[model samples]
Target: MRSVSRRSLLRGGALGVAAVTVAGCAEQEPRQAQRLAAEPPDPETMLIRQLIAGKERTVALYSSADSDRLTPFRQRHEAHLAELRRRLPRESGSASPASSAGAQADPSASPSGAATAGSQISVRDLRDMERKAAALRPRQLDGVSPALAQLIASIGACEAAHALALSRSL
Candidate 1:
């Protein structure tokens, strides 16, 4: 007859926990989010990729730390990436972003945060971005497709929320 001792059971439970921890770490693809795929020469595609990279980094940071406070903000960032990519021109869908007047002239843009300008944004920084997005609306809506206006408005609202969340988190 086999006897199950208390110490043996405790050791088995500990082993189970260790196995789960190792499995969790093994399943993580930490660098996949940083790998922006090479696409054709499309500014819109490049911009979308930039947005995705930024959002993914933020999400990863929050996820690794198990922070629930950032859930909504991370979701909004993901939405902006998905929505903007869906609305971009197909030809420019795979191209790299261009640093020219043509790309600059795009009134319809995404919220990429202060990271785009080579700095980290504070709570106030997010609020400023929201305000800027709202101001852009009047001019951006001028003679453009209704779709564009709606998209910008959606992003504006989300950006505002991000500002509020940042303030609370900080």
Candidate 2:
């Protein structure tokens, strides 16, 4: 019977471990990738998406109205939407929510409508929306980046102004 040296046995064991480790890692690579792909988006991305949806709704509401007075308001909302879109991470699929909604004469006519038909979006409705959006801004500030927080604050201020302006228009 051949005698195996301790060093030789140790070396063989080490090699076996190395081979198993390499094989295990190779098997796990795809699983790790799948897990990563399945993970939910980050907080900032989610907030940005929510903001985009709200702005889209607001723009649609403004579009539904025929008032010349609301054009600038709609334009401002559009600009805000553009900025929000720019901030969205590219890897997060930066597709804007159904931009076609912005063109509809009445938001109620669109699927997943913001308002009921025959109850046209009045100045009071817009004012209430602006007020609510502004009030929610501070809560949204937490857990966001400084730049995003600043942008949100500015937007809130603008919304507050919009609310005030809409109030005066009535």
TM-score, every prediction: 0.43, 0.68
Q: For model 2, what is the error of residue 56's alpha carbon versus the real structure, in angstroms, after optimal superposition?
A: 0.6
C-alpha lDDT values of all predictions: 0.51, 0.77
lDDT of 2 at 44: 86
Clash list (residue pairs), candidate 2: none
Worst-scoring 10-residue span by lDDT in model 1:
99-108
Lowest lDDT block of 10, candidate 2: 100-109
Q: Write the per-residue lDDT of candidate 1 for residues 23-76, one digit (tens) a residue.
A: 887666444433433434453344444444443444443344344655666567
Scored by lDDT, model 2 comes in at: 0.77
lDDT of residue 151 for candidate 2: 93
